[model samples]
Structure formats: structure tokens, C-alpha cells
Target: MYDYVKGQVTRITPEYIALEVQNIGYQLFTPNPYAFRVNEQIQLVYVHMHVREDAHTLYGFTSLEQRELFRKLIQVSGIGPKGALAILASGAPTHVIQAIEMEDEAFLVKFPGVGKKTARQMILDLKGKLGTLMDVVELPSTEDELPLFGMNPYGHELEEAMLALIALGYSEKELAKVKPQLEEDEALTTTDAYMKQALKVLLKMK
Candidate 1:
């Protein structure tokens, strides 16, 4: 029902961000909630609404291209919304598109919950369909180093990053393997930074 939401980010949690508009808060589950900063200036978030008998959910993205890629992902067999979110959480939609186009099942299966069968199905279903999105897919920086920021004394940033990864279907066991490393990395001060580093570690573990 919502094409986009224009509002200030009033709150952010591991699972979702609350965009307050007209005295109401709309909870939007995104691939990366930390990508948005709380109390930031008003912005437009393109949204996709998924409705079921049990509940209605809204998945938000920074751009329409991201939303479109998400929509396409969910249509693939064996891939649900959460799985799609996990794929996007890598922050490398360009890489995903390249994998799909190249029929590289190895790259696609690296994401949590994606098996070899699902990977092949994704290629069979979406290979030629994603060409248009390639031009618009935002390529994330290839740098291994992320910008540093002031650390939260309570360690809420790292905790939130962990929770977001769990919500994306990563197991606690997998996170346990990386938590110490994340805590030890002084450069990861912001939740976004922690998330990026954690994802890199998790992908490497695969």
C-alpha cells in the first residue's frame, strides 16, 4: 500500500526502523537498519508491503532499485523475505547481480539459507531477468576499511549489529565465532561499521 515513506527516522532497532510521519510511526524492516541514522533529516524510503494471514510487513530500502532487487529475490523458489534480506545485507547487490548473470552458484550459495539447489534455481529463474537492474545497482566500496566514529560506551552498536545479523537468519553460533573479533576491532564504532565487518567475517566463514 505504501509506495514510499517520507519522514524522519525516529527510531532504529536491529530488525527495523521507525519512520514517524504525521504523528504515527511506521515500522519498516530493512536489509540493513543501521544504514539509517536516527533523527536524520526527512528522507524518502521506497517500500514493499508483504501481507499474510498472520500479519502485514513493510520492507524498506534506500532506493527503488534495492526494493526492486528485493522483490525479484523473493519470487525465486526457496527464497523468502528473510532470505532475500540476508542476501541484500551483504551490501553488495552488484555482486549478487553479477553472480546471477554469471550463473555462479558458489557465490549465491554463500548467503545463509541458500543451498545448492536454491542457487541453481535462482540462476534458472532470475539470470536474464536482472540485466536492467545492473546499471542501477549501487556498488558498495571495495575498501576493507570502514570509516571510524565515536564508540558507544555501552557497546550497543556491536550488540545491535549482532541482532540485525540474527534477524537476517544468521545463527548465534556463527555470530559467536565473530563477536570477539568484532569487539576487539576498535575501528568498528558504529553499528553500520560493525555490521559490515561482521558480514565480511561471516561470508569468509562460509
Candidate 2:
């Protein structure tokens, strides 16, 4: 029922980020947790609460358009929260919209958990429906000004990126294939950078 939360990001893990507001910490599962930087200043995260029989979970996004896309994706058969997160994690909402609009099942199936049938279902269900979101959904920029944190002596950032990819339903085999390349890239200093690079690689592999 909650629409959003505004707070300082206190922790960033593979599965979620901890947002502290007034001494309370809200754990928000996001498409890309690494995208959020731990900061002193408050940031806004639009949220969707998913209620299940066993547990209630909250999914957060950097923008309302992203959240809206998530909502639309989950409405399709076979696309759950986790699957939707994997698609959004690519940080190319416009590309997704274009693929759907163009009925590009090849591009749609590149996302984890989306096979031919699901891709067809998505096109059948939401092709023209996402026209509104196409205009509003913003592409994620690499030039974020926020200062990155959570660095350690060891190669924790790469490990975290791998774990995050696993959480998004990528198999270890897929990650292992790219591990060596990611390790060799000195420019990937932060988890966010590693994640962005890894996703590009994985999408190419598809």
C-alpha cells in the first residue's frame, strides 16, 4: 500500500538495500541494489508492496516510471517480481519498450526467465499498452554524481556483483564464464560498475 520511502541508504547488499528513516530501517529489494549509493542525504525510492501468503515483500525503484514498468511486467504470465527485477536490472527500459512494441521476441528472451512463450505473452498482453511508459521511462545514466561507497581490501565488489547476478536468477555457469573478464577489468572499481559491465556481457551472451 505504501507508495514510496525517503531515507538515507545505510546498507547495500546483493539482495536488498537498507534505508534508514527516523531510526527505522526499511529493507527494499531492488532491480539493481548496487545502483544505490550509501549516502548521508535522503533519497527517494518508489515502492511496491507484494503480499503473499507467507511473507510480505517490498520492491523499490529509482523512479516512478521504473516502478510502473515493473508493475506492467509482473502482470504478464510467467513474469514474477524476480524476473521483472532481472529485466529492469538491465537499466534499459526504453529498449524493453521498443522490443515489445516491435514484437522482438529475440530481444525479449534475452532476459533471464523469459523464454519464447513468455516473450509472446508479453507482446500479446503489453505491446501497445506501454506507450505511456515509453515516454516517461528514463534510461539509467552512468554519469551519476553520487559518491560510491562499500569498498573493502579484498575483491568484495566483484563478489557482490556476482551474488547479485545470482539473485537475479543467473546461473553460476553464466557468471563463471564472465568472472575472469570482470576480474581483469581494473576500471570496474565499484559494485555498480561491475554490475553494469556484467549485465552488458550477459545480454551479449544471450
Candidate 3:
């Protein structure tokens, strides 16, 4: 029922970004919340509404192609939203389509949850149908946005970094243990730098 919402990114969680538009907050689930920065410009989240028996949900994508590819992935048997997200997280959609078309079961099985059987099913179900989609599915650009040094000394970037860590599989309890140490450090400008620092702190926390 909705096309897109344009608002400042106020809160970014592991699985969602809360956009503040017109005194209201819309929490959008995206594949990568780090793609957005706090207090950044308004974002246009190309959305897909997913309705199951017990839940009604909205999933957002950075691009139309990502949304379309996500739609196709969920159509395959045994592939749910989480599984499809894990596939996209590898940051390689064309590779996935190519593997499906080529029936390269080994490549498909390499993803987080895909085993031999699921991989084969993907090939059987989606091989030929993905050619048109492949032509349009381009990976999002990977250029670093902001610098790594002397950015948010107040721990804004550090907080965002922790959210990203959770998205990458770290738990809240784990992040909490080391967050104070991270805040004790200097400010970081870019998200990438914060990610690196958080990883280091997490390793030391272990």
C-alpha cells in the first residue's frame, strides 16, 4: 500500500532502521542497516510487504533490483525471509543467479543455510527464470562513505558499529560487555572504521 518513505535515519538496529517522518517513526527491515547513517539524508526504501498466517511485515531494499531478487528468492521452496537475507548478506546476487542457472550445486551450498538438497532445489526451481532478473541485479556500491578517525566522539558511530555487529551475528549481551571499552576510545568518523574497532574490542572481550 506504500511506495516509499522519505525521512531522516534516527535509529538503526541490526535488522531495521527507524525513519522519523512527520513526527512518526517507521521501522523498516533491510538487509544492511549500516547502509544508512544516523542523522543522514532522507532515504527511499523500496519496500515489499510480506504477509504470513500470523504476521504482517514489511521488508525494505536499497534498490529495486534487490527487492526483485529478494522476491524471487523467497519463491523457491524452503527459502524463507531469513534464509534469503543470509544469501543476500554475502553481497553477491549475480553469483547466486549464475550458480542457479549453471546448476552449480557446490556454489549454492556454500551459503549459510543452503545444503546440497536445498541448492539443487534452487537450481531446479529458478534456473531459467532468472535471466531477466540477472540483467538488472547489480551489487550496491562499496565505496567508504566517511572517514575513520575523529568523527563521533560521543559514541554515536560506536553505537552504530555495535548494531552492525549484532547484524553480523554478535549478541546484545556480548556487545554490552565491550561497549564501554569502545566508548573509552576516541571518536570515529566512518562506519567501516567503527566496525573494525568493534571487532577488535569483541575479540579482546572473548
Candidate 4:
């Protein structure tokens, strides 16, 4: 029922964002909730409203490109919204588009929930359709990497994060570029936090 909301970002939790639009707060679940800034202006969030027997949910994206990709992803036989979100969470839409186009089932299945059958189905279903969205895909490269961890960080945390990214389907080259940016932060610990940070970095690059 909603197209988009232009408002101030009042809150950001790990899973969702609260935007105050015209004195109302809209809770929006995104692929990565960290992508928004508190008090920043947002525009044109293409949305998907999911209604279940017990509840109603609204998911939002900054751009129609991401929403379109999300829509196509969930249409696959074995993929669901959560699974599709995880796939989108990786922040490398171009690689995903490429994987679909190239029929790279091996590569596509590396995401958190994707399997060989689902990957093949993604290719069969969305290969040619995602071409225009290729421009929106952002694979992090060396020169244009985003900051991952906090300032003055340790190498181990970044390394572990890289491992997690690899486990999440990022390539060595892509991880290498972002590693320095992540290493700059000293406060982070454990692979999970690193995974979160890594995803944030990857998404920003996108």
C-alpha cells in the first residue's frame, strides 16, 4: 500500500529502521538496516508489504533496483523472503546478476541459504531479466573500499571477517580490497561482528 517515505531516520537497530514521516513512525525491515543514517533524509524506498495469517510486515529498499532483485529472488522455487534477503545482504548485486547470467550455480549456492537447486532455479528464472540492474551492483574494489571496523583496529578481527565473507560468498580479491579498511578499526571482536561490519562495507560499496 506504500510506495515510499521521505523522512528523518529516528532509529536503527540491527534488523530494522524507524523512519518518522509526517509525524508517524514506519518500521521498515531492509536487507541491511545499518545502511541508513540517523537524521538523514531518505527518498523513494520501493517497498514490499508481506502479510501472513498472523501478522503484517513491510520491507523497504533505497532503490527500486534492489527491490526488483529481491522480488525475482523470492520467486525461485526454494527461496523465501528471508533467504532472498540474506542473498541481497551480501551487497554484491552485480556478482549475483553475473552468477545468474553465467549459470554459476556453484557461486550462487554459497550464500547463507542458497543451495544448488535454488541457484540453478535462480539462473533459469532471472538470468536475462536482471540485466538493467547490473549498474546498481557494487563489488568492492581496492581503491574505493569502505571503512569496515572502527578506528585503529587489529588485523585478526579483519582477517576473521574476511573468512566470514568468503564463507558468505565473497571472493579473495574482493575481500583483499576491503581488508585494509576493516583492519583500521580496533574495537571489534569475533567473526559475527566482523561479518556484520563486512556486510556493511560491502553494501556501501554497492
Candidate 5:
């Protein structure tokens, strides 16, 4: 029933965000919750309201394309809201689209709860149906090249950036190669700054 919510981010967790709009806090589960900051002003999230017999849940996304992809994923028989969320959690929807278009069952199976049968089912259901979203599909050059979700500001910036990068599907091996450059950058002071610089370094490595 809800298309989107515009408000301030009052709280953020690894899995969800509490967005306060007009004196009410609406909990929204997003693919990249850490990408948001606590108390951020005037954030807009495209949302999906999932109603089940036992509960009603809100899934949110930063962009329209992300929300649209989530909707399509859940329409597949074997993929539920949680499973779809796991697929989107990688912060790289482009790769998902690419896998579907290429009929890459092995790549699709990497997401949690997706098996050989489910992967094939996804391809069967969505392969040629994905529309305009295809125009925006740009795969990450390297795993770390996926966009950086912002990190906690209270802790060590570099440490938080590393955690966010890891959550975005970057391997420890890739991170180790760039950690020194990030640490040695004397001008970088905030998690956002570190995240941006780290993304630049990672993209350069690609």
C-alpha cells in the first residue's frame, strides 16, 4: 500500500532502519541498511509492504530500480521476502540481472536459500521479463567496486569501512590489498570519507 516514505533516519541496524515521519517511526528493512546514517535528514525510500497471515512487513530500497527488482524477485515461486532480501543484500543488483539474462544458474545459486531448482525457476520466471531495469545494469568491476554503504561514525572509521565493504561481498584478500592505502591516507577522517576513498581505490584496482 505504501509506495515510499520521506523522513529522517532515527535509527539504523544491520538489518533495518527506523524512519521517523510525522512523529511516527516506521521500521523498514532495506538491502543495505548500513548505507544510511542515524538521524539523516529528509531521506526518501521506495517501499514494499509485504502482508502475510501472521505479520505485515516493510521492505525499503534507496532507489526505484532496487524496489522494482525486489518486487520481481518475490514473484518467483521459491523466493520469499527474506530470500529476496538476501539476494539484494549483496548491493549489486546489476549482477543479478546479468545472471538472469545470461542464464547463469551457478551465479544465481550463490544467494542464500537459492538452490539449483530455485535458480532455474528464477530464470524461467524472469529471464526475458526484466525491462527498463536492464538499461541500468552495470556490474561491479571487482567485488569491492560495488558501491560503499556508509559506516558507523562513532567507531574507528577505517574499521567500520572494512566491515561495510565485507558486508557488500568483498573478500578479505581484496580488502587486504587496499587496507594499507586507506590507513595511510592522513586526510580521511570520517567513515563516509573512508568509504568513498576505499571505493575509488578498489575501482582503480579493477
Candidate 6:
């Protein structure tokens, strides 16, 4: 029933972000949790409610097209919310649409959890239905709101931000690629700032 949640990101983890909207913190699972920074106020999370026998969860997205594709992905046989999210994490919805259109099962099967059967099912179910998604899906921009540096000698904020990034689905190897740049920048002082900087490096990282 909820359409969106506008709030600050108060917490981040490997699978979810806790967005505090009014007085309540909603746990929202997203494709790229690290794309957001902690405590940056006023973000709109386009949402979908996924209900199961034991619990209900909210899957959040940065844009309408992302949310719509997520919904569509779950409707296909053998594609659950988590599976759909892993596929979306590639940041290449256009490539996925093209693959489906082209019936390139190999490319589609390259995504995590997608196999030959699932790939063909996706093509069979969604060949021409994804044009609107392709036309509208664009990368959401991350705004670096603050710089966190030179505030403390111990670098606690940087440490915490690194842990948070690790929690936000970034591997240690991936963080190692950008850690030196962050270390060299003495301008980062807060976890949010470091998180923002880290996200910039990650989004640019191929």
C-alpha cells in the first residue's frame, strides 16, 4: 500500500537500509544499498511491498522504472525478490532488456541465480514488455553533501564508513580498490561523507 518513503538513511547493512521517516524506521531492501549515505536527509524511495507467509518486506528503489522492473521480475517463474535484486545490482537494466529482446540466454544467465531455464522464461515472458523500462531506466545520481576530514586524528568515522560499506554488499576486495584514494583525502570527517565518497568511487568502478 505504500508508494514511497521520504526520510534520512539512519542505518546501512549488506541487505537493507533503515530509513527513519516519521518516528519509525522502515527496513528497505535495495539493489544497491551503498548508493546511499547515512543521515543524508530527504530521499524518496520508490517502494514495493513483498508479502510472504511469515513476514512482509519492503523493497526500495531509486526510481519508478527500477521499482517497476523489480515488480515485473518477481512475476516471472523462479524469480524471487532476492534473485531479482541480484540481477538489478549489475546496474545494467538496459543490457538486460537488450539481452531479452535478442534472446541471448548466455548473457542473461551470467547474472547471479539465473540459469538456462530462468533465462528462457524471462525471454518468453517479457520480450516486448520491457520497452518502457528501457526508455526510463537511468542511473540515479548520488549527491555528496559533506566532506569528512581533518576533524579527528583517530579516523573513527572512516573506519565506521568502511564497515558500513562492507555491510552494504561491497566486498573487501572492492573496497581495497578505492581505500587508498579515500585515505589520501584528508577532507572526509563523517561517516556520511566517507560513505558518499566511497559510493562515488564504487559507481565509477568497472
Measured with C-alpha atoms, the lDDT of residue 153 in candidate 4 is: 22
List the RMSD of every prediction in angstroms: 10.1, 11.0, 10.3, 10.8, 10.4, 12.0
- Can you write out model 6's per-residue Cα lDDT over 154-196, one digit (the tens) per residue? 2555676788878779999999899878877756634566789
Tens-digit lDDT string for candidate 4 (61-139): 8777788788888888888888877777653455677667667676676577777878878888887777678776554
Local distance difference test values of all predictions, in order:
0.79, 0.80, 0.71, 0.69, 0.79, 0.77
Cα error, residue 191 of model 4, in Å, equals: 10
What does candidate 5 score on TM?
0.69
Clashes counted in candidate 6 amount to 7
Please say which candidate is ahead in TM-score: 2 or 4: 2
Cα lDDT for residue 159, candidate 3: 66
- What lDDT tens digits, residue by residue, belong to model 2 across residues 167-189? 78999999999988987875565
Question: Model 1 residue 7 lDDT?
Answer: 93
Q: How accurate locally is residue 106 in candidate 6, as Cα lDDT from 0 to 100? A: 70
The numbered model that scores best in lDDT is 2
Worst 10 residues of 5 by lDDT: 145-154
Clashing pairs in 5: none
Worst 10 residues of 3 by lDDT: 144-153
Q: In angstroms, how far off is 95's CA in candidate 6?
A: 1.6
For model 1, the superposed segments whose C-alpha errors exceed 4 Å read: 137-180, 183-206
Which 10 consecutive residues of model 2 have the lowest summed lDDT?
A: 145-154
Any idea what lDDT model 1 has?
A: 0.79
Residue 143 deviation, candidate 6, in Å?
Answer: 37
Decreasing lDDT order of the candidates: 2, 1, 5, 6, 3, 4
Using lDDT as the yardstick, the better of models 3 and 5 is: 5
Candidates 1 and 4 compared: the better one by TM-score is: 1
Superposed Cα deviation of residue 12, candidate 3 (Å): 1.0
